[model samples]
Target: MINKGANDLGGFLRSRRERLTPDAAGIEPGVTRRRVPGLRREELAELAGVSVGYYTRLEQGVSTSASDAVIDALAAALRLDPAEHEHLRILATPRRPTRPRARRSKLRPSVRDLLAAIPGSPAIVIDHRADVLAWNRLGHALLAGHVDFDAPDSRVRPNIARMLFLDPHHRALYRDWHAKAQVTVAALHQAVARHPADPGLEHLVGRLAVDSPEFARMWARRPVRTCSSYLRELAHPVVGRVTLVNETVTLPDDDQQIGLFYARPGTTDADALILLAQSFERRLAPGTPSRKEEAR
Candidate 1:
């Protein structure tokens, strides 16, 4: 197992250093010698408004407590994208103090009601480990029509990342599987950093690393990504290809995440999504019952 804490810090510094070129950072390359690919330590220190020795120590993983001002300067100097910048902050800072793990209680009545009310949009509430804690009817239909929904404790419940890398059916559903897989692995990497002691997440990562060579390579790359929003191309069997935007909102009280998938209006993709919604409704109609009945 990788020492996630050290790896997170080392990976961020290395990524930032690799991305900043001498030309990009306005540093003139000397004719005498040039060995490093990106910005040299001295040049990066100059750009980041810090001493070369201090920056060197940081890059060496000898120190983690660079002030906010220093972090901002480094972020600006390296020209980090927003997500990368946020990830840098997370990597440099200490994990927030947390209590021992506990089995999360059931969702509040209001949240369940809210999911029920969203008839058209597909949405689900998941835990930190990407376990599908709850899902709206549309969400159930949109993602995994073959699975039973009523039994939340069922072992067969869909895990978004696991499905992305392990299940052929789910992999085929994604038109941009490579990009989606990268983001998924990156987000999981970030989660690993945040929750290093989570055995469940550790086990999941271990399983993926063993089961999928692509996942193993991507995990080795150590990309840190945040799941705020992203676009996905989903190839639904019934709906065909539909471009959807996924947004994640964190629940305040717990380590739960609510994800919403939306398709833009005034497009063929949107029409297909509507058809999918209608198909789901038909499946839930009088004669056609839920999967709970079929299993019995």
Candidate 2:
């Protein structure tokens, strides 16, 4: 598995450069037929104002470091977005992570209180490794009422990435599973790059690479993203259907985030959220079997 660091820089650069054609990059195509789809290595090196030998060394992972000016020129040549540019820098010159616990990270009580305060909304807190640290009652009901609400507090906590790829119950929640799966993989790439020393994160990637062919394929593609908000459509078993505006509030100090989902006001979708709250109130009991378990 490709854990994000100096190792994947070459692959990531190759992937990005392969997607840009000669015409798109303002390079003239000569009479010679090209073997590759996009800009040739020498052409890209010329565009970025670097020598062919040096650029070749960089792309082949022989040269692990690059100056800021070189990174800027390469980012410009590749037409990388802000996120991709950040990712390139991280891979090219990785900073030692200040906090590398390599174990289960904890949630602050204040964050849990905030989730509880938003009773009608579906709110959850997840750490950098995508472990579900905590979720309010409505959040639990809206996403995974089939599982115990307190599962996050257990020794074996719920992991969002694992659920998305490995759990059939969680997969059924998404109306457009592939889209979310893509985002999840990209987000994981960002996380892995930022915290390369985190063993839990490494193990998560390793396990998914082994278990899910689809995830393995996506992982190999080297997508990099950092998410702040998302628009998602869910075919919830209880709610039937609802479109949620998911906003992520990052806690940089703790490497955790609070995810809040809201529907537009005065719509049927708004009413459905209330129904989820009520359903949770009706059936959520300590040690009681979840709806999925009862079905079994």
Candidate 3:
């Protein structure tokens, strides 16, 4: 019997394969024209030191006997990054019980302290589901001042992926909305693949697909993006135009991470961040309700 998981593995492989170009793979272009965008199945099979028949069967979702060595060769031939390689392994692994594993969403005390330590910088702790577990005052103010900081941890917790596509305020925050949206969707795609048996995540994806047309379109594209340090331009309602380098610190032995948003020290954007932090601090003083408390 053909395994459905193996079928998905095949599709994932094909997608990654198509992302590579023949020239990029060090293949010289011949006079004979090719049809597809990337390297042919035979070309890839040869590069991975596998039979063409085996590679073709793998791509067609009809083969499930690929060994670890074969998968590693395929990854190397496709030039997959660390995250992509991990993803490929997941797809190729045999699926057992679909029961969801216990999700660890609680932020460590040290991680929470780390967020408070970075006053001037906007930082947040998020789970694999992109749910904002905790955020510094500046982080709340910078990203979603209109919403409560405590709201994320509340019953109706706010997820970054959900807000990117569904919330008007969140959508307006990005200067390049479409580029940011694409990245957000692609990252979520990776997340979904990472936690395939998580029913909650599957529900989130289904809800987004039903509610947001743009999300459905992007999700259909099956774009895979691994989140890393990247620059983002935000049109904050309070701070106006601000650019920051968002760095993610993947927690050790945990599924949560702290995302720090900071501008270059000597720049005007850095100055803006400082000002925003100060404003949040002032709002937290006696007699003044925090933006979060007031929202409650």
Candidate 4:
């Protein structure tokens, strides 16, 4: 039986193993009923061409230094996709002294300007901790209209992951909250593995774990997910239902990711975005009463 020890890698391995059946791994089930779930330690070790003792040590967090060939073999045996394979590699890699991570990461002015260039679509730049670093007007309107448009310019930036779990408005925005929650939590895990020394990311994870039971439940799953592009269904307060393709690209120079969300041209979804833009424009027009003013 595979058990997760104190190690994150061990936890991840345990989660993966639980989901993979012996029949799926092409192992014939014996007539004897199994007591523990998933492929046994010895079975997986045999498939990876490693001794059961060494594999057990690796899973138990006693030994983390696994060869590339062994990682590759294990990945193949487990049928991991590209992103999952990369995540596994990061977990197994030895930790090194990393430079201090700033709480608010700066983006080149050119990139910020680029975000504004696409007026029709919504775009945002976020750091590894999922803190909003910069956002286009439409992006702010779509994701966080309740927030000040210039919130990202401040020292204390709003974190998307935090809002997703804790803020009721943000939680209501997603049509499928569970799906988005899972992906967000998994991304956090990936970030921690890649940037082991990032204090900001560390704090975010700790904060969410304590404050949000939903986040805590998802975090315990030891998920690892990296998505370049996905569809997001939003129940926008102004525009009603919206389906947009969220495309994210990692900036080469830094760990920041820039994402643009847009719908296919000429669809009702596009029309919904157009309506959202119009409402936002009117709200920001000259002499328009602000949310605070209206509240007063």
Candidate 5:
């Protein structure tokens, strides 16, 4: 019996196959018209050194137990990048069924301290669901000062994906909101493949799809992307436009959490960050209501 995972794997393979053209794969387009949009199954099988019948079975969800060598060869034939290769591996493998239990999605105290120790850089830690688990003072100010730093523990947690679309404050925070939205949706797509059995992730996706038409459209496009270090421009209300290299580091000890670090050295952008930090310090003064409280 083909399981949901196997079916999803087959669909992903078919979608990827349809994305490549015969000419792009260095194959003759042929004099006759082609019925398939991209490289045919037989052609892909030949490139991957597998029999056409076996490849067909793989694509049809009849064979889900592909060897690592076969998976690697297929990834090469498809010309997949690092992120795509990782997504392909996730689809081909089945996730072990998770027992129904409440899992703590909190950051470690030591990690929180480490985030605070990084003086000049704005940093925050996020869980697998993109919930801001913990952040330093500057990070809180730069990203979502309007939302409480302790919001992650509350019923209304600050999910990056949710904020990107639903929250006007978060949308206005980005200088290039469209580009950031595309990346955010794509990363969520990859996460769905990685954690197929996670109900929380499923719920988040479903909720966004229902609430935001833009998100629904993007989700339908099936963009697959994972996060990486890249230059980001932020339209910070207090400090104005700020540019920084945003790098997300995955912790091996706590795979569920990713640490996002932002830095801009020796430039006005650095000065902007310092000003933002100072503003956050002012917000913390005695008898001063935080930005979060002022909004209430």
Candidate 6:
């Protein structure tokens, strides 16, 4: 088996180097001999304030304990964006001294209650790996009408990012698939940085890269984006067209995140959302009692 632990560091360094050109780094390419487009090893070393031999060792995965300052210099030398800079820190940091605790998989009852109380808004809580831990009825209807809300922990549960890239339903739901795809990839890139040792996350990324050519291509570009707040234009099958402002808030006590979706106060989209909620309620009425009754 490939030592993915070391390969990740080496792969990232090689990719960053190949992405830059000698001219871009203000280094003249010698007419005599040149094998690569980017700055040579010596040039990158000089720019990053390290010896050529030391830089080579780092790239070859021989040296893994680089200081934050050194990694920052390397990032600056590579012309990394915010996302890439963060990734470099993650990759260069030494392995944890102690094994990390297994992430808690269950959502707190209080959090579920909060989601249920948001009657008009659609909201969900996701774990660090972007697994859907829980969602309100409206959230289930808005994001994955075809998925089973009662079985969130099931393997069949929908992943927002995975659906965006692999599922045809998501492709049709978002008006601008390219834009949504970029954000999804960027968010995944950030998540990878935060949890580099997570085997489950690694497997998911590998599967997506292998299965979707589009995902593979975008992953190579190494775009980094954080989606704290954004507007989503959703083409709901029942609601037709609606624009919702999405916000992601971190839970105070855990690594869970809550995503909330809201429409403007007095717009046609808001009306459509109300109609969609009503339709969703009707659909669920036969299977279970009213949401209020369930709470009681």
Off by over 4 Å in 2: 2-7, 94-100, 285-296
The C-alpha TM-scores of every prediction are 0.82, 0.91, 0.81, 0.90, 0.86, 0.86
RMSD of 2: 4.0
Q: Considering summed lDDT, which 10 consecutive residues are worst modelled in model 4?
A: 1-10
Q: Which candidate is the best by TM-score?
A: 2
Over the stretch 68-109, how does candidate 4's per-residue lDDT look in tens digits? 898898888888888888888878887767796766688788
For residue 79, give model 4's deviation from the true position in Å. Answer: 2.1
User: lDDT for each of the candidates?
Assistant: 0.77, 0.84, 0.79, 0.83, 0.78, 0.78
Displacement of the residue 51 alpha carbon in candidate 5, Å: 3.2
lDDT of 4 at 258: 94
Clashes of each: 0, 0, 0, 0, 0, 0
Shift in Å, residue 79, candidate 6: 2.0
* Residue 141 lDDT in candidate 4: 91
Residue-wise lDDT of candidate 3 within 1-296, one digit each (tens)?
A: 11224226777788777889998899999899999989899989989999999899988878744688988999999998887787777667766667785553676777777887877788988877788888888899988888876886677678888998999999899998888888777766666666777766666777888889898887766666677787898899877999899898887577777889988798999999988877877876756765654543
lDDT of 4 at 126: 91
Alpha-carbon error at 184 in model 6, in Å? 2.6
Which residue ranges in model 1 land beyond 4 Å of their true spot?
Answer: 32-34, 95-106, 155-157, 224-227, 264-267, 281-296
Per-residue accuracy of model 5 over 1-296 as CA lDDT, tens digit each = 11234226677788788888987899986898899899889999999999999999988888865888988999999988787787778777865776632344756878877886885788888876777777776788889999877676577578899999999998998988888888888777776776676677777888888899998887766677776777888998899998888887887566555556466577898889888988888878866765654543
Candidate 6 accuracy as lDDT: 0.78
Q: What stretches of model 5 exceed 4 Å from their correct place? A: 1-7, 100-104, 286-296
Evaluated against the true structure, the overall lDDT of model 5 is 0.78
